[model samples]
Target: MYVLAVLSVLHLCCSSPATSQDWPLDCTARKTIPYHSDNGRLFREDDVWNYTTVILREDLGLIVLGTRGVIYALDINNINTKKASVKWDVTDTQQTECTYKGKDQEIDCQNYIRILHTIEDGRIFVCGTNAFNPMCDYMNYTEGQLILQNDQEDGKGKCPFDPFQRFSSVWVEGELYSATSMNFLGSEPVVMRGSPEPIRTEFKTSWLNEPNFVFMDHIPEGANSPTGDDDKVYLFFSETAVEYDFYHKLAVSRVARVCKGDLGGQRTLQRKWTSFVKARLECPVLESQLPYLVQDVFRLCPDDDWNSCIFYAVFTPQMDSSDYSAVCAYSMHDIQQVFTEGKFKTPVTVETSFVKWVMFSGDLPTPRPGACIDAEAREQGIQSSLDLPDKTLQFIRDRPLMDQAVQPISSRPLLVKKGAWFLRIVVAPVAALDGATYPVMFIGTDSGSVLKAVDYPADNAADTFIIEEVQLFQSSNAIKILRLSESTGHLLVGSEVGIVQMPLSSCGRYKSCADCVLARDPYCAWDLTSGQCTAISSAQTQAKRKLIQNLQDGDTSLCPPSEKAKMINTSFVMGSNVKLKCELISNLAEATWYRGDNQLAPSDKHHISRDSLVIPNAGSDDAGMYTCWSTEGIAGHVHRRQEAEFKLTLGTEDPIAPQARSASKGLVGLQVLVVFLSLMLGILVGWNFYKGHFPLPCMQKQRQSSIEDSQADVPGVLEPLHCTEDKTTAPAGNSNNNHTDLANTVPVDGHATEESSI
Candidate 1:
């Protein structure tokens, strides 16, 4: 026992947050459940994996998944129930040619569906790596089956050549807008819209500079726009910084925009975009450290008003063992302010060769550069992009970068998680019982768990609460995509193995009003009619006495007093052991034992284990009414409730020691086995350490990854180290977490994220 206690302390001292995923801390209503196993529906395939591209058609109650050479449509109501499937595989000749180009036949030479999105007219736009010969085709959904189009288009800029490249695309107004590499070697990256001759970014590094795109979405410019601007397509990515000087190349996150109606330049840029502009996205604008890189982005628009939209993104630091992930939000108003009125950054030669980005301070053009041909520009006779002057195009072509960075809404990170790196984010606006809507954030982490957090935008000072966390995937595989369906109240989780449809809430798990109200779950409320905790959405149809909830303040004061706990009688002889058992429903609650009105403390004669109160040598004073109380802190209040009560008397009885109720013999045998196994493991580890088989540190950097040129450092797909797919196909175990970082933390030249535990 002493050795174990010493080892526990030593382990705590040696452990770093960067090296491991600690238990969720400071989170109100923190409860973890295997909700996926008990309630989720999974769809899997034997030979096919990598279900990265998932398109949900809530209207049809179906979810379409794009995998290796095949697309499967599954019923959203039950993911395990397949509705339809279609195959579009790579031919043997294509595979041969891809292998001749020195690509891995099994991993890289096979077709992996990279793009699957709804185009127009209920049709779908699909693109695949197609064995390194990128090709795209349209599919028509008719009568529950996919009809593949005969004519195909060259997917140079529409789809990525490498399956593991960080890629993104969006379909807007019947046109495909994409951000990906244009070559087999992934050297030429472009952000372009598909057309006969697509208008794209310049070939120069000044425009993109080794970018790894994560997300792209179309945001329509509403009538409220002061300039009546054209619709916009925004891109989120991390790229190598051209302006910073550091020991190694620094990577910075950026939010770039392109007008949806932008056409290629008239003369100076020819086929290049004239309205493409990008600005730095500072998650936390701090002079002391570099900003975290964007891993995934989500846009939450509660209503039809475009001004109400908010972009929430997940971020991770470049390198070093900080074991941290951050969440930041940016308003569309702020993003537009930076791109429209902000100063442009131009590349200027500082010395003989070094080039740096500096604010361009020069004469302005007749039509503002990077401004869409909106009502104002149209009234000025700038009818279309083709009619724009060569002078304006030249200015825009030379300076596509912005100087004033777009900081997060509050100029600080909304949440900085220490234990796990958040890989994906999706927000759902849930109407709570309080009549106010709350944006509940579902964050996917590196450990395959989904964290449900609630943010109160009305009150910025109110702390974001992580209400619950649930393991959605059985394996340790990371969650690459998280899609929330408000209509169905489900969160669709996509991993390498398959897809899982998890319900948003399970309120029946909380039996008491205190537990229900203290949960503060926007989806759940205490239904007074049924006299039970239930989901508000499901209970709306039934007649109810009342529905009560307190989201802003998890006020237990509003709840009726907790029911009295029944007392259990137990008699024990003096000098014998006395044990009172208590079961904890919430791990966040603090448990304390009291005898009558006095609190019990651990002494030589008494001890309190996790689930029980033990008296070593029972005395007469120990014979009294013992009650176990649970106190939980929520929304600035301490809510206490009785969990169990027991009364002890001075007489020998059958159920004397509750701990010994089942079988003292079995318990002793299990304890001995555990001690024996622990001793053996310790001896073996010590022997290996003495033999110099390994280092003293629990984990040490095994090898130093060599630096590559800017082009060589293409951040791998879903990059940021472990945030990507694990090298091993099936995980070794379903354990919640493991220690240390990925082998090569940052293999890319422009590292976006560090996968050290976080």
Candidate 2:
């Protein structure tokens, strides 16, 4: 539990910087025509049932299915043109007499019968709910619909008859895998794809009390097989926690898995459900609400590096109360071990101990092809079941981590943590445009707004989570997120109104334009001409400036200490452009630009960058301290770089900044004025004290001198000027002595007062 508590703690870890000026969440990048399947919305009339499921095809086009069961192939690449804004109609194949087509359908072509479809191998596989008609009919036997054609009860093709049923289908390795459970009559959970042979797992309950399949995703390859180890699939569902006269009080979240080869075959008899372990996922805050319902699970697939095998799910314990919801996550590797080892043998419910989890160090390595090591343990000749120990998988189950806080339902676009093991991404809300994406996140809102973001630390989690509306549509609509190509960095987003495409290179990426210019990250960076993020030559400028800074201070070295240790000090030729970046740490610090020994005038070129000095278009003439000092912001602070000489001697060039005489004069005058004011204040204080008002110990001598002169000096010595009352009390000896001293001081005319104060 200590490991669990510590792992759950969310630490503020710093990562890389951002690179681009991302689009606002609500701006619509592009618009695509949405095709609805039926005349009315799926359930609500106002809510035009547009796309419900969307996936990018292998060739870069988009395949989306509307809630009304209308399937469309949006030619994303053709529609997303940069300069031209034109309208194009999407090709529809709904009118054909295809399998799963509605029966008694008038030529009006408006009846609702189909569900959704998965695209693969140049053909579309479709399925639908037989709830209204209850009969699976209408198929064109020749086209090979590949789905919705099961003949278990009779040779005629039809899906297992079950209403109130939820199903999901995905194409894996050119074949479709459908996860479906029966509520009307069947006793087992089924995974099929129109094959007569179906893989089944028995976990029966009442008809109305049917279980709901929540989510499914792929796991790390070759880690949990007996002989032929392959990538496995994960399924999340809310099953019975306890059987009773009435259905169980709560639906418990459970995890299940099926191998690629085990999809549709004679594996029905053997309950070889690899990861069929049940766990009670409970959020203390959400468990006490009404109509306790499980929040939908969102699956994130890794981009390239590590296989996190992580799945995110949000649960609203009181389904009736939307506010009381908590987001919970679990790892598939952990679930696999719990089932394979048979640990914690108990029914599922929302309890803390139900789903044991683990976190891997970095991302899990992808498995090799044709790997069957995990699948060989069950064979009689196998030496041991734990022959190839997957420490990474076991590690995740033992020390799983969870987020401490749950974000709002429609937060920001989904963003992935840089270097995070799982394909982690954040989805958030934008203004109106449904959503946008960088690479990792899918951001959208329940209110028809969305933001798609990748984990670029510079953008920060708070900003990344908010969906920036890329393009606003005319009406409110739900948007689907898509990352068209990582290599090209194209984001394709589609809403009920239209489709949008944007090239997101800047988001959370580069720390500064100089950094981007140096690293050549294909993201946002400094452009001299336009002064914006654009494609340009970055290395030449970065290298020259880096060389100059290294020669001067060696402190601006971007390389780590260990790497710098191996490098030899060197110099390079100055190119056409260079940048001098001077960092001022304090907010109050003012940076002054200088060339050579003379201070340069603060010009447009000598500007303060984000906490640093930027020589926008640095030329040989513009070399130098570019010294930025903090004189007053945080008082008495002086940060000066004296040897900051940019020795730019052209074929024949004289010093340029005799022009900055004004800056130099101003600085010197300020210093002199400060000194003069101090002396004047001292003289005024001395005079006041002699008159017996606000007297100071240090001015006592001056006061005594004045009194003595007033008494001793009468005609030539100075008269003893005194108050009328004090004259009577004045002694003859004191008066005479004061008059003499006053005579000497009077000749000076307060000269002594001025000299002493100075």
Q: Judging by lDDT against the true structure, name the best candidate.
A: 1
The total of clashing pairs for model 2 equals 91
lDDT of 1 by residue, 373-438 (tens): 888888988887888998898888888888999987766666666566789999888888767888
For 1-758, candidate 2 gives per-residue lDDT tens digits of 53334233222121222223121221221111123321111212233343344454544344333333333444445433221111111113433332234422222223222333344444444444333222232222122221323331221112323323444455565444556644334444554434445444434332113456655555546644334555666665565544222323655555555555442212222322322224444333211322233435655544432244445554433232123223334555455444443323212234765442222224332221112324344453423222323442232222222211122222322222211011112332111111222223444333343333323233333222211233323335544323344434455444444444454433223233333332222233344443333432232344322211111111223432211112112122333233444443222334565554555555676654434444554455554323433221111123232212233322333222444667778888998998899889988886665444564433334455545443454222222234232223445565543223222223344333211211
Question: For each candidate, what is the lDDT?
Answer: 0.79, 0.36
Question: How close to the true structure is residue 37 of candidate 1, measured as C-alpha lDDT?
Answer: 67
List the RMSD of every prediction in angstroms.
27.4, 24.3
Any runs in candidate 1 off by more than 4 Å, and if so which?
A: 1-29, 222-226, 285-288, 457-460, 569-581, 601-623, 648-758
In candidate 2, which residue ranges exceed 4 Å CA deviation? Answer: 1-48, 58-69, 78-120, 129-166, 181-194, 206-209, 223-230, 239-248, 262-275, 280-308, 312-332, 347-378, 381-439, 453-523, 526-529, 534-758
- Give the TM-score comparing model 2 with the true structure, all chains together: 0.42
The residue pairs found clashing in candidate 1 are: 164-717, 421-758
